[model samples]
Target: MSTVLELSDVTVTRSGTTILDQVSWKVDSSERWVILGPNGAGKTTMLQVAAALMHPSLGTADVLGQRIGSVDLFELRPRIGFASTAMARRVPASESVIDVVLTAAYSVTGRWNEQYEELDVRRASRVLAEWKLSHLEQRRFGELSDGEQKRVQIARAVMTDPELLLLDEPAASLDLGAREELLQLLGGYASSPYAPGIIMVTHHVEEIPPGFTHALLLDQGKVAAAGPIGEVITSEVLSGTFGLPLTVDETDGRFTARAADR
Candidate 1:
């Protein structure tokens, strides 16, 4: 499989503090990887580098065959799809859901003066329907529930048929029902052969979609374990990543974790 994302000894430092330390990993074109970690484990920082949104402070990072810092990020960004809370916060609250997805073609947060073609509008509508957001097409971004907003963000991210997709905590802050709905939708996407290679960061194992193929567990700015999902997502690894003794359970391709018995 062709490598879609590659990181070797990648590190990020800010204000004399290191967030990611010598994190080396690679993602291939056919894989969907879920990243698991605690709050300060540098999952988001690694994602920023993968999305070409931030350059690593040291070491080489590559996306879609282009090395970070040596490539034109403007040209590289469009080929990468990203959906995150940080990205969602930039969307205009008054923007209609359809327009929110439409603007992705231009790589903007809000609809603007750029003239959109009929085909663009059709594609946006098609994507909204795919993500089950068609019913909310005319709703303002802020008016929708958290689940609805998440689906819209994902729709917008894939609007450009990007080669790599990055999702950061797509199910965060949602009620149980809302989270399951979004996870079901994500599961369907993950199973699709045509979907782009994906990397999703989440705090909980239960949020991992059914079709995801790989897992990366991060602990304090470094990898705890990384490999096939069934191999790397064991109770021991999860416990190591989160700094707690965890009991991991899996049934029907979904996982759950809790404090282990003493």
Candidate 2:
């Protein structure tokens, strides 16, 4: 499979402090990866680099075969599907659900006076149906439940049929049932051969969708371990990444982690 993302010794510095330190990683078109790390561990930074939203202070980042510094991000960004709280904040609260997904075709947060073709409208409806948001098409974006809003955001992200999908903390702030429902939806999407390469940043192991193929553990802005999910998401790695003793368990391809006994 072709490489979707490649980060070679990528580093990001802010205010004279390093945010991401010499992070080297690669993602291929056939793999679905979960990024696990505590807050400030550079998970978001990594996604930002992959999404072409931020250029690294040092080293190289290549997304979809285009070098970061050498390419026009406007051309690159359209090929990448990115969903994050930051992106959500830019959406007009009163935007209708269908419009939310439809506007993605133009890479805008709100629908303007631009005329949409019939094909675009059809595509938006299909995406919403895929995410189980068809029933809420007329509802205002802000009126939906948290889980519904997240699903809508994801639908909007994928509406343009991107080659690489980046989701930062997709399940953050969700209740148990809501998180599980979203994970199940994500699992179904990830299992599809037609789905794009996916990189999801999440704090809780339980938030990982079932069909995700690999895991990357980040700590102190560095990769602690990265490989198959079974190998990279061990108790020791989780403990080290979180800077605390953690007990981890996996059953039926789902994972859970918690503080280890004292």
Candidate 3:
């Protein structure tokens, strides 16, 4: 499979605090990768580089075959989809559901004077339907439940049929029912052959969707293990990655983890 993202010795320093340290990773077009780490592991920072929103302080980042810092990011960014709480917070509370997804074509949150054509409207409708939000087309964005808002954010991300999809804590704060519902839909999307290369950042193993093919564990902003999901998510790897003794279990394509018996 072709590589959608390639990072080599990338480092990000913010006010003398280094977030990522000499990190190297690759994401292929056919892979669904889950980035696992405790808070401050630089998961979100890494995703920013991948999304063309942040430039590394050291080393090189190549996204979508174009090396960052050498290409026009405005053109490069549209090819990649990104959904996160930060992006969600930027959406206007009064924006309609359909407009929230439609405005993504122009990479804007709240619609201004930009004009859209019939084809764009049709595409937005199709994306909303795909994400099961067609019925909520006219609803205000802020009026949706947390789960529904998350779905709308994802729908907006995929509206342009991006090649690389980045999700940052898509299931972060939801009740059990909402989390399960979102996971069910996310699992189906990840399993689709038409879906883009997916990279999700989540702290809980339980939040991982079923169809994810690979895992990347990070500790202190460095890669602890990276490989196929089964191989990298072993008890030993996870224990080390989280700096605690833990046991990992899998059943029916889902996973769970807990502290090791004392």
Lowest summed-lDDT stretch of 10 residues in model 1?
235-244
Error of 3 at 258 (Å): 1.0
| 52: Cα error in model 3, Å | 0.8
For model 3, how does the per-residue alpha-carbon lDDT over 8-60 read when each residue is reduced to its tens digit?
99999999999999999999999999999989999999889999999999999
Candidate 2 lDDT over 1-262, as tens digits, reads 8999999999999999999999999999999999988788899899999999999999999999999999988998999999998998899999999999999988999988979999999999999999988999999998988889899999999999999999989999999999989999999999999999999999889899999999998888999999999998899888877789989999998998889999
Q: Residue 219 error for model 2, in Å?
A: 0.8
Off by over 4 Å in 3: none
lDDT of each structure? 0.93, 0.94, 0.94
TM-score, predicted candidate 1 vs. hidden true structure: 0.98
TM-score of each: 0.98, 0.98, 0.98
Stretches of candidate 2 exceeding 4 Å from the true structure: none
